[model samples]
Target chain A: MSDRSSARAARAANPDYKILVVDDEPDLERLIRQRMRRHIRSGRYGFEFAGNGIEALEKLVELPDIDIVLSDINMPKMDGLTLLQQIPEVNSDIRSVIVSAYGDMENIRTAMNRGAFDFVTKPIDFADLQVTIDRTLRHLDEWRAALASRDKLVALQNELDVATKIQQSILPDTFPHVDGCEIFGCMEAARNVGGDFFDVIRLDRGCLGLAVADVSDKGVPAALFMMSSRTLLKGAAVGVGDPALVLAEVNDLLNETNDAAMFVTVFYGVYDPSTRVLTFSNGGHNPPLVVHADGSSEELELTGGIALGAVPHFEYGQASVQLQPGDLVVFFTDGVTEAINLANEEFGLETLQALFEDGEARSAREAAEMILQAVREFAGEAPQFDDLTCMTLRVADE
Target chain B: MNVQAEHHDGVLVAKVEGRVDSSNSQDFERQLHEAFGDDAGAVVMDLGQLAYISSAGLRVVLLVAKTLGQRNVGISLCSLSGPVQSVFEISGFNRIIQIHENRTAALAAAGK
Candidate 1:
């Protein structure tokens, strides 16, 4: 059988469906209703009537389940074409058909253009009307199903937005203060959430702790791992005896369930407030730059083991530096130095070190700002591919 | 910066107000230490009037709490607004510090 016949057969197989008829002529409406009574009486379908587009809209509001709208082209107050245009806006899932006694080519084209499901000329063909109603109702069912799925997708998007907000709220909002020291830091994510994180914590007995870390990969999973690592680091710093030992314990804790194959690069340190001394350990992280008081700086050589979550038994090594007053330590993720320009030239460590040689950075904050400005200038219009994060620390004389 | 201290029954209540940045953190710290110098049984801090707080402010709170913890004296923070509460929560201060909705609840929790 044809597609229309198949649709009608499907509707006949499933009794108890509804269709709405909208037209201005009472006689025509009566005749259509009388012809439709056979299908209604047979429990195949039900029929409702509307005098114009206005009445049809009211009926739609009252009964949202009115499967399809069979309307006339010429009607008082509101027409079939107008109703078709409004259907998608108000309730796009409701299928519509345009029926008219005077069916010209222009009217048919106009009705179809206005989003009518189909156009039927009126000489009172009951068989054709049944087929049209059946096909329209089938189309309406599919449209409604698609709309339901879209609504669910929108709800999921809203939930994700809320989750992102909660994650952002957990991060440190502002930097801390140290006497006679200036500090600067920035975090830029390629997506909603990033893997890079930095923190400056105050320790007991005139001591301060500093940390910079990069979780493997990006997005939600990385963000989650970053949070867990942050919490574990805080707990270890507060409870663990030494920085290297803290990383060892954190590594074991993280490797407990190592199925995801995720890992992190970290540099954790603690600075003595009285002696201007900072002791730190690296866990396969990038070496940070240590700027001296006499306008000189050098990269702190990495002396630690592999990154966390690589192996359960790995150990990190610690290093110490006596920072004089006005000395600065600059820590960053790979994003900053690796940021590329339109010419594909990376803002490498050499360029960063060169910016420091300008001798314009009087404080740690100025140093951070200068590096950020240099990177932005170098990148020009190129979009950031990863999270750009940095932290600066200045030691003060007691 | 506004610092107000009053002794109610055996509880010492200190109300801190305004921004607590590096410039005024020392003054706030000094005032808090002085208020707690008399070996008060319990100290309740009312932060409702506090509008802005930086890491310096956080350090002051942490220091006071640690000092009180060592002395076996209880410290309770109360009436924290949304922003101040957010700062504390982000820094994990809420986890270590005892935060209450009001001074009465805070004082009661501190065994005042």
Candidate 2:
């Protein structure tokens, strides 16, 4: 299951690894050199000699490429532990290996606490020292690889920002100009990108098509789903006059390759300017409120359809409501009613309806803003869990 | 969320308690499956204590139901509170899966 060994083999094979040997004994350098003579002769490892911790620090600053330091514990100027702490200041990439008297567990533990990568003992077994060196280098290689992957994650976050822009651009920013009425929509996107979106499309013959949909996930995957659903809904809406039929076709198209089992709940409707009637259908979405001209609002009757991409060829029902003068239809996703406070209580439908039922009548944009503002106030200080998207259609008074 | 199961007349009654949102939906699925196994002729999810269920949790329930249905295993739900019931209805889960008013009725129906 682990590819660490192979990764080490591929990366740590030939680097002429540089190690600084720090010991007070003058003869110890020659012994290490003679022992590692073959590795030095071949282009595998290069060794540098330092008499003590201070000298090692100097050599390290002089030769910045030294990868590891093998230091002895006892020295007059400075100790191995002191050098281990200073190595990071000079080059964080370097690791220190401590050498001490055999069976000196106390000093070895202290060396480890001070950031020693590994240790060798006095009367050193050269074979053990070789193994320790290989282990230390392998650890360093994996550490660097992990840091590199972290950088890739940061790059991925930047890509998510681009996705946010694409999602924002997909929704129809400018509401369609419908005579005898005004349409406005706003989506307060959550911190993490969600799949909530609203669109207003100008159809043929002065009929405006409106849609608000919420996909079932968050982040890039849900953003992609939201984009495709928006495109498919708009594509199907242009030719199809019936809200039920448009959704039916979009459902089939989305189901074709829904390997992730993702689904979207859509409320698609078309408004005829001449008649002032809006025919709409629901796809397992929360029913929107119809705020009448007198400020009395009622929840729209659900047309009885499951979410799209769940059951293909599912029959959908549609109904129409005549938009009386001064009437406003408030369309919203669950994010509005389902917005939760720190107390873990949802801003339920009753609260939303009460807010809309107030006396003063507002414009399309103003109505949408009022509802959003109420939800935000209700969830004061609690992080917005989902995209708070709402659309309003206000018929101008005669 | 937590799932407790007790067998009654070949039915595995899973008593789901607490909230099941995106964070714990995976564990909910695992616990439900561990309780159901291959032998229960029918399953009933008792949701009287379940406070909230997000779309993610609903997806899991749908998955279990569809998968078990394909294997000829019957699954139903019971005792969903008002808000939870509305959520299930809005998602149209009530149409595909049977929902009983209480555990007694759920067991009675599953026993048949």
Give the Å error, residue A393, model 2.
1.4
Candidate 1 CAPRI grade: incorrect
Give every collision pair in model 1: none
Worst ten in a row by lDDT for model 2 chain A: A6-15
DockQ of each: 0.01, 0.51
Question: Where in model 2 is the C-alpha error above 4 Å?
Answer: A1-17, A22-26, A37-46, A50-65, A72-86, A98-135, A138-142
Cα TM-score per model: 0.67, 0.86
lDDT per residue (tens digit) for residues A130-189 in model 2 = 999989989988998999999999998888887777777776678766679999998988
lDDT of 1 at A337: 75
